[model samples]
Target: MPEPYEERTGRRQTGPFAGQTKSPTDRDGRAVTFEAGAKQPGYVPPLSDHLSPNQAHLGSTSAASQPSAEDYLQMGIDKHEKSQGDEELSESAHYFRKAAEGGSAAGCVFYGLALRHGWGVQRDEKQAFGWLEMGCATVMQKPSTDIVDLDRRQSLMPMGTQNKLSAEVIMAIYEVGNCFEHAWGVPGTKRNQPNHQMAAMYYRLGAEQGDRDNQEHLANLLSQGKYGLKKDMWEAAFWYRAAIDNGLSPIGLSWVYKVRLLANQIRAGWP
Candidate 1:
């Protein structure tokens, strides 16, 4: 300390405990600062460890045609049937049971579903899982291969089209389609089933959410006075306008060319 401060510049030091200067430099004499919280380039953190904005929105996607669980299981059954068309009941039971045991509630439901339809064997609800319901809930709950396929197909979405939509919206649109088309598993009862009234309700819900398909179905139903709904041309035209807003170019043409032409011909012939 009694000498000048320049005397401490070039002193050679040895051993682990020999360093005494406040400045710590590397061999290149460059001072480096090590930060603990810094992130490296292209680091994708785990889902549980760090959820990004994109990862957080995984469950929110709107689907136009959400296939039911029964639909899925029936597809598998169809494949099996096409492969082994001449197989006996006992032989086919193995295929259905295999699908059932592998967590496809649809598979379980369809074992009963096939029995109900007497596809491969005698109709026996007693022989199947009577309580296992598929489609509406199971399709939404499980991690299905069908859903995974849909995910892969939708991976390359344009940036402007990706929006966070709720599962309820998807289910509602699916219900609307089933009601309009009289799809399988939609209740066939006169009071509660896919009648015009039910179709109208589902269509309104889906249309309010900006689905043009629903708008078109609703318009068609209104135009024809089907499903016990009153005939109202003005109301029908309003729904067509909504469909037009949602990119219904072909739908617009069909309404103009086919339906209107048929209606005009029918009116001309009405004596």
Candidate 2:
């Protein structure tokens, strides 16, 4: 009989790989001896290489998938309204700051409020004034010519132009007036001196823009003749009428009617 195969080959008789065949070629098919733990010559393409040009472009433009300024502002408002604790308020303020940075007027106003009141962030009245001023400028900086043009175009104007004065703009204007009236973030004495003239100016700005709330406040101020403003019953009646025309409810209407009647009487020399 022939010698045992394993003994002739000088190989182990048992154990792993003892009976395995060895190829003349290397592990990767090169005409060389196979070595343990050798580096492989494989390559992995980048993720972008696998995508089409259009897909790559879409991925590059992923910022378009992010929430818009208005979306962030709304989210902030929702969070603030529904918050039950300081942590939630902080989250709300964070979203408001993002929206403000992204150019939402309402976001600027609310961010200012947050800073002023320390609701979520530190109370920094000076910083709050800066944001409030920005919001005020955004609403009040529109050109008078734009208002005239919008009024003239009326039905022909684009929807955006027709609704240029959003609720946020109105609220910003009102808040700016409040800031002036109360000196909340203004530089002045520690006693918080009021800036009646500036308050009246902002209130007029909002009232002129068809904000019923501002119109009512302006009417009250004009009627009272306080806050450094001269008594002007005619102007007060005009604003009261405007407020009524802008959908004041029955309760509001009643108050406006009484004020308008009293203003008329005062103008007509009646006590």
The prediction achieving the highest lDDT against the true structure is: 2
lDDT of model 1 at residue 93?
43
Candidate 2, pairs of clashing residues:
none
Per residue, candidate 2 scores C-alpha lDDT tens digits across 1-271 of 1122223334311111112233222111122333577422211112222122222221111144678776776677666656655666788789889988988777787788777656567777778877876775653443221324534542221345444565566666776666665566665524246555556667876787777667766776676666555677777778877877876444533554666678689999998
What does the lDDT come to for candidate 1? 0.41
Model 1: CA > 4 A from native: 1-172, 175-177, 180-194, 250-271
Tens-place lDDT per residue, model 1, 144-198, is: 2232453454322233544543333333333324323342234323323335554
Cα displacement (angstroms), candidate 2, residue 213, comes to 0.9
